[model samples]
Target: MKKIAYLLSVMFLFSAFAPAAMAKGVKKEKTELTAEQLVRVGEIESRVAEIKSMDFSEMSKAEKNSVKTELKEMNKEARALNNGVYLSVGAIIVILLIVILLT
Candidate 1:
């Protein structure tokens, strides 16, 4: 029937838009680290170990705090970058469609 067809179209449109709308609202927690960041962290840890071996008291509190802050920001940026690189919206939609079909 015409009404049934119209209803189906409306439902289809709603389903298509709903996921995107929800995805936009949902914030992915940024936590993924990049290779560069991993390297930097390793370097920092190595430096810290070297400093400790030489003299743990040599590093001022301010210097240690600055390193910690830099590492934390690097980690956060790495996470945001990861979300951009992986989990693309199109991929998510395709996966969603596949799952829906499977169900």
Candidate 2:
């Protein structure tokens, strides 16, 4: 009974994580800077640095608020463009737990 339960739980864990870890024996391709995206991200980063270096004391409150909003929008855009694979820390911990339990 315990063996059956363990097998079922392990199978469940594998099924849950299988999709993201599907390329088990496959070679992964490089996922960076292969297009105009690098140039755009570079431009955004440069603009952000320029804004950061500016004297905020010389600016009005409204101007500062606008700059903050612009930075937030740029951050959102960068995140949208950054469609990288995300590994879940919780999932990793759970997988480790399962492995320990199994052994």
Per-candidate Cα RMSD to the true structure, in Å, reads: 12.0, 4.8
All candidates: TM-score: 0.30, 0.51
Q: Candidate 2: worst 10 consecutive residues by lDDT?
A: 25-34
Candidate 1 has a TM-score of 0.30
lDDT of every model, 2 decimals: 0.67, 0.86
Worst 10 residues of 1 by lDDT: 77-86
How many residue pairs clash per model? 0, 0
TM-score of decoy 2: 0.51
In candidate 2, what are the lDDT values of residues 1-103, reduced to their tens digit?
A: 9999799878988798797598677866766765799888999999999998999999999999999999999997888788666568997888788887788
